[model samples]
Target: MFSATILSVLGSVALVAGHFTITYPEMRGDSFATGASQYIYPCANVNQTAETNRTEWPLTGGSIALDLGHAWTYAFINVGLGTDYPVTNYSLTNDRPLNITGKGDLCMEKLDLPAGLTVTDGQNATIQVVTVGETGTALYNCADIIFKTSATVLSSDDCPSNSNITTATVEEVSTNETSSTNSTADATTTTTTSGAVGTTSSLATAGFVGVAAVVIGWLL
Candidate 1:
């Protein structure tokens, strides 16, 4: 019975674990193609050797959007400056972590570059979006960009933000062999209300990072 229950829960998760794509600033490559895995470190299965279609991002800050696959995710934004190596150093864009509620076309109009992280005109960089859900694997996608002094982010019909969403920090707990439960990140919790009028809740345990998403009355 226990094994059957695991299979049933995992079966539902299979539909939601399709990964995500960067919409605003073009994606590096098609990470959702057949036989592609977004969990492959820095930039998924994108061919980093070849130059991608670089979007003109403002020097100060610009818009960033994601076409998400999961119902909701504990998402993180990191920026990698320069093309020095295939795996560049990625710095978190925000001090407070962001959790995006709902699965489609979520946009942030002015996502600034990391504070004190300087850049000049025509400098190359990459915007990395890492999403984690019930599966516990950190899926990643990136958008290649060129910093410009006069660049601007124009919103499109496709980049609409979701209403009735939860955008806050969902605390991540790290578990060790000795201790099974240890909370981190100031114990900040976020609540999300999604789906139709009479919504059903769900619990998503990202076991790898030990983070459990509580979407209010979530069924285990």
Candidate 2:
């Protein structure tokens, strides 16, 4: 009975450490995929349907949430405003800790546009998260957004470079055993896994890091 209990606990922990997804502002629909395989640009996805389109929200302020499957040590969140498909033109706005313990439901963060910046009432934007580890592997998630604005639509050329936006980078925590962290920033959130030597090894060796990156790229 004791052995069975131990196995069950381990199994539960393993399952919890295998996935992460955006839960707020509604993510692009991709039920068949999980983890990093669930996104392509903002609203584009293999399993996307017309219903998958996210509802338009006010561009000024809102909250973003993440559903963590495993613990991570660091997270970086970026928000981009664009008229293009891939929406590569963006700025980093948030960097913080995510899921430091490896088990949690939803981590929420606030988001706000920079002062003096203007967004048209109908402009399209995207929120992306990049969770990294010392192992050099990362997980990503992107969500589409339509800002409530009355300003005229601007072309890609009209959009300015990310250089104008102020960015903040949080220092990574130092440790010996492998661990993860989770953080929520203004309108964005990032979750990353890091640690000394013990717990993080399981995450690095899970062989899902490379696969997750490929899946994200493939979907794009």
Candidate 3:
């Protein structure tokens, strides 16, 4: 009787423990931006139409420079003609990322400006710069003619600045793995214990019935 009682109590405890320990490991996701800006230009694509295209002034210092490390997910580029554009979408379509922060002299930030667009007289254009993650891309609009004047491209080896790649990481607790393993073991043990208890209870009931039958035969 005592043994049976102990087995029943152990099985119940095991089942309860396994249920509680199953929810151990989890993951969390988050995102943040250090700095961001919103600007728009009404510059139409010079190649798209013969009408006067939009124009912008050059940075007073002759270059647009930006710190790449300041952003993590999405950079927006507005042509003033269209809605904002993500840097990645623009960069992938072309060879290099666009530079809204014009770093090069006559350097059109958007490397893949239509061939028809030209920068003349070193006129400067404004760019709406958006940056994504550490490894994201940008697309700048480079129209050859801004406001009927031809735009020129100034070539420079180290023009627009580049910064280190931004990074995002997700981490779990150090003991997460161990706790997960322990939970699995506990679940397995609980199942085994419950099965064994069921078998023992059935055997005990059968033995009692058989003894009762033998005792009746002796009395007869």
Please tell me which predicted candidate would have the highest lDDT against the true structure.
1
**Tens digits of per-residue lDDT for model 3 on 48-124?**
33332334333221223233323222223322223122122222112212222211112123233333444444442
What ranges in model 3 sit over 4 Å off? 1-65, 69-73, 82-110, 114-126, 133-149, 157-160, 163-220
TM-score: which candidate is best?
1
* 1 or 3, greater by lDDT: 1
- What would the TM-score be for candidate 3 when compared with the true structure? 0.24
Query: In candidate 2, what are the lDDT values of residues 30-105, reduced to their tens digit?
Result: 4335532432333324333455465465667455555555443244556677644445344434223332444343
For each candidate, how many residue pairs have backbone atoms clashing (under 3 Å)? 0, 33, 27
Worst lDDT run of 10 residues, candidate 2, spans: 193-202
Task: Tell me each candidate's TM-score.
Answer: 0.67, 0.50, 0.24
Candidate 1 displacement at residue 74 in angstroms:
0.7
RMSD of every candidate to native, in Å, equals 9.8, 14.1, 30.7
Clashes of 1: 0
In candidate 3, what residue range of length 10 has the lowest lDDT sum?
21-30
Off by over 4 Å in 1: 1-17, 49-51, 84-92, 156-158, 170-186, 189-220
